[model samples]
Target: MSAPWLADAVVLAHLAFILFVMFGGLLVLRWPRLAWLHLPAAAWGVAVEWTGWICPLTPLENALRERAGQQAYGGDFVQHYIMPLIYPDGLTRHTQLVLGALVLLLNVTVYAALWRRRGGRRG
Candidate 1:
């Protein structure tokens, strides 16, 4: 595959992963086994945001862009792409912390509901 195509694929995959990390815990409600996959993913997502670490995908995408004869962009994937669409003001450390907290809050709420529905038992 060409570098441009590969870069686009990476961007799409990154978006999907973000969505999954943000909401995949809800899937555990229907498939208990999913918790094994989603719990760790959610934690990793939270950790990445809280620690202000750029995801590995960002560099891969940037490299792909360069290989495609395109200019490499600065900042993480969000700043280069998602931020332009949703957060015109740009991303900041505070925003990253908020994103981390949001991830934690949403997952906790979903897991709490799951726990309550499961008779307060650990699943």
Candidate 2:
């Protein structure tokens, strides 16, 4: 209801979505049948970072915060909250790219392992 509370809610939701996008592949690895859901989400996450497109949720959350009279944060929510805990100074573009690459690499590795296990079962 209040500005700060609304902003906090937005920040929390944004963080949850980021976590889901980053780790959802692990879930898919456990249940390979969910590739249909996880693959698209993973692709979208990668595409958003590669293209420098602001996630729709970011803008919507900011708008809501602004309407609530809270100061809207500029960068991605990860940069605002998560990065500070790990990196003292701040997040740079290079760091963001590295993080994105790590997510992509992790998902790729999981998918490959799953494929091998499935193939072995068939063999």
Candidate 3:
């Protein structure tokens, strides 16, 4: 594969992972039985960001890009793609923490709402 092709694949995979991290709970909400699967994935996603850990996917993408002679990015995939759109300046520790917290808070709120709905039906 060419360098550009590898870069594009990495970009797509990164985007998909982000979507899964951010909204996997929405899938769980739709299929309540999958809560077990989604919860862990959501937790892993939050933990990865909070700990400043590079997701396995990021490295895999970088490796593929390198094989194709593309220049791999230094930071996380989010910093390469999403940050520029959201922040004109750059990513900071505070912004990273806030993003991680927001992901946790959103999932928590979604689960709470689902629990309340389930409880209402029992009553």
* Candidate whose TM-score is highest: 1
Off by over 4 Å in 2: 1-9, 120-123
Give the alpha carbon lDDT tens digit for every residue of 28-94 in model 3: 7788887887788789878877888887777777887888777778888778788899996878888
- What's the residue-level lDDT of 49 in candidate 1? 88
Tens-digit per-residue lDDT, 12-120, candidate 1: 9999999999989888889878999999999989999889888999999999999999988888877778778878999989988998999999999999998889899
**What TM-score does each of the candidates earn?**
0.94, 0.82, 0.86
lDDT winner between candidates 2 and 3: 3
- Per-residue lDDT of candidate 2, residues 1-123 (tens digit): 876576678778877767767887788778878888888877877777766667777777788878877778887766767889999788887777777788799889888888887785563
> Relative to the true structure, how large is the alpha-carbon lDDT of every model?
0.91, 0.78, 0.82
Best by lDDT: 1
Which pairs clash inside model 2? none
Residue 91, candidate 3: how far off, in angstroms?
1.2
lDDT of 2: 0.78
Candidate 1 lDDT score at position 35: 94
* Model 1 score (lDDT): 0.91
Compared to the true structure, candidate 1 yields what TM-score? 0.94
